[model samples]
Target: MMRKTLTSVWPLFFGLGIIGVCIGAQGSLLGIRAELEGFDIRVTGLLMSAYYVGFLLGSLRAPKILQRVGHIRAFAALTALASITILVHSLIIDPWTWGLMRLLTGFAVSAIYVVAESWLNQAANNRSRGQLLSIYMVTMLAGLSSGQFLLKLADPASFELFTLISVLISLAAIPILITATPMPSFEAARPVSIKALYHLAPTGLIGSFLINTCYAMVLGMGAVYASKLGMQVDEISLFMAVLVVGGMLLQWPLGKLSDRMDRRSVICAAAFAALLFALVSGQTGFAADNRHLLLALLFGGCCFPLLALYLALTNDELTSDQAVGASSTLLLVGGIGATLGPFMISLTMERWGAPGFFWCLAAMSALMAGHAFYRRLIDPLPAAGEPSSFQMQAPSPVGSGLMKSPPSEN
Candidate 1:
């Protein structure tokens, strides 16, 4: 059964892997490049935040696009736009132009995730759903993590890295565009309002926003922070790769543990873990000691899965009918947080220097852990039925298979 599932989805997965590679490389590439160009830290923050702003916009608009053009055409168009935009970053050196392109890239990438996840969800049966989603997460992590190594392939100052990213994005289209599989049908669900979502699952809603804020800080500014600490490109790539792998390693175990007990407990533990790591990182001077790899792993493991945990926490309180719509709400909330995190962190960094990065992380972690414990005390209600099962998340509205799985014919 697993073999047959792989056969059916190989083309899609292969293409998605390429997309993962592009995404992983592009953010760090731009951040490193910005540092090399001597762009102001706050300006770089604005540039990075623009992507999340565009992402929020695209996530809202993408369902309509997928509905109109269908998946194949929508995917093709978005990838082509993203491909062109990434290469343009190399041609133009201005922060404003890069900001524009970064926004476009975010817009295109978010929609592409909608396409990829929506298509995968439609392809699964009950038995295959878990297997497929598991494979999907692994493929994404492996691809994205491996792509970090591509940093070692060329100088950050040269156009070569950007070109490599462009080439990967372009090649991703080939497998997807050529697939003979039937296109998935799509319908945009009416999203629950933030007020409604908060009322329903305060912990989940607030957690999503807070955790993603920290996440975006790291994603947008991590390379920049590392560069500021005087690390070389090769060391930066390895450190970055360690962060990705750390998240992958912990997501499943924590998810399984969440399914068995109060997820908020796991959520609290994870958040506290982050706080501890952040404290340690800050004290250690944010890579002052030689344990750059260890600090990166501990940091990634503690922080990366919080959004997914919050997604499940929200959905645990939702009826199946509402789960689909809430996916958009949670993603939008996270995106908004992501949009603001970098600029805020950049200000902190400017004020305190490199250690400011970990300080911001520690504060966010404290808030998340404190809130989760507080909410659990105030509202202890569980889902009316079994809680929604946790999955390793992909940060897309649909593709992460966060919605209750479609009823199985089998």
Candidate 2:
């Protein structure tokens, strides 16, 4: 399955890998740059959070646009937009300008993801789809993590890194543009209402939102936090890289474990574990020692997998027919959480300084653990039904679209 899928679908994975790298580098660069540019934490939070706002909007709208222009043109146009945004950051460093640029960049990236995953769906069959997705998760993470190291190559304060970011975003378009890929048909997912989803799987819905809120803080504002703490460039790059790699390595093991038993147990356990790591990360002065980087790896390992776990838990409550819509609904819920995370966490950072970042993290983890524990006490999985099989992904609007696609026809 791996061999066949890779042979047929390498271009999509390759192109996406480059995009992942750009995304990783761009976020870290902006966060570090924002600090050096002397933007207040509140403004930085708003700037960073704007991406998720654009992301959520793009995810909702990308299907309609793709249906209008077709996949190739959509990918080309979106990539061009993303590339342009990278350069714009270098030219204009104002908080408001960057906030708007962040929104546009998020929109373009999210739309590209929607189109790219649709392209992959056209390439995969049932037997190979799972393998393809696992590979996809790894490819995206590897690129993302590796991009963090690119920080060492140039000064975050200079135009050079911005140029590199724009070049990579532009370069990612090549494999897709040159390949003769078919446009996969778009049947816009009718996401279940948020109210309905909450009632159906309260833990899943809430857990999805809360866990992703944590993820956004760790990813989007992590560099900013490191910068605030007086970390050098190499340390900041390592910090972000460790978090992504943790998510990459642990997602499958944690996800596959959930498939074997009650998923809420897994979610509860993971949440609690994250709470502990969050405590250690903040209270211990994570910046005080090099060894503390392990906290990020552990925190991310526990938090990232919950995205897939909550999706599975929600699906376990749903009929196969309802699963797809619910998945779309969860994406919206989580995306909103991600969107708010930076701003909310930034408020804490403003009050408490860098420690406020993980204090907010610890508080959220505790909340997640409490809620999951409450759900586990009140609601349990049925003995008669099996949980949905886990789908490992670097979940985004595009990745969510991949998960909601038709079950593989082997």
Per-residue lDDT of model 1, residues 210-274, tens digit only: 98888788878888888888888987778778887888889888888888888898899999998
Maximum-TM-score candidate: 2
Sequence-dependent TM-score of model 2 = 0.95
- For candidate 1, the lDDT comes to 0.83
Stretches of model 2 off by over 4 angstroms after superposition: 286-289, 395-399, 402-410
* Model 1 lDDT, residue 240, Cα: 78
The alpha-carbon deviation from the true structure for residue 326 of candidate 2, after best TM-score superposition, in angstroms, is 1.4
Distance (Å) between predicted and true CA of 345, model 2? 0.7
After superposition, the stretches of candidate 1 with alpha carbons farther than 4 Å from their true spots are 286-289, 380-384, 395-410
| TM-score for each of the candidates | 0.95, 0.95
Candidate 1 pairs with clashing backbones = 117-399
Tell me the whole-model lDDT of each prediction, alpha carbons only: 0.83, 0.83
Alpha-carbon shift of residue 256 in model 1 (angstroms): 0.9
lDDT at residue 155 of model 2 (Cα atoms):
91
Position 229, candidate 1: lDDT: 85
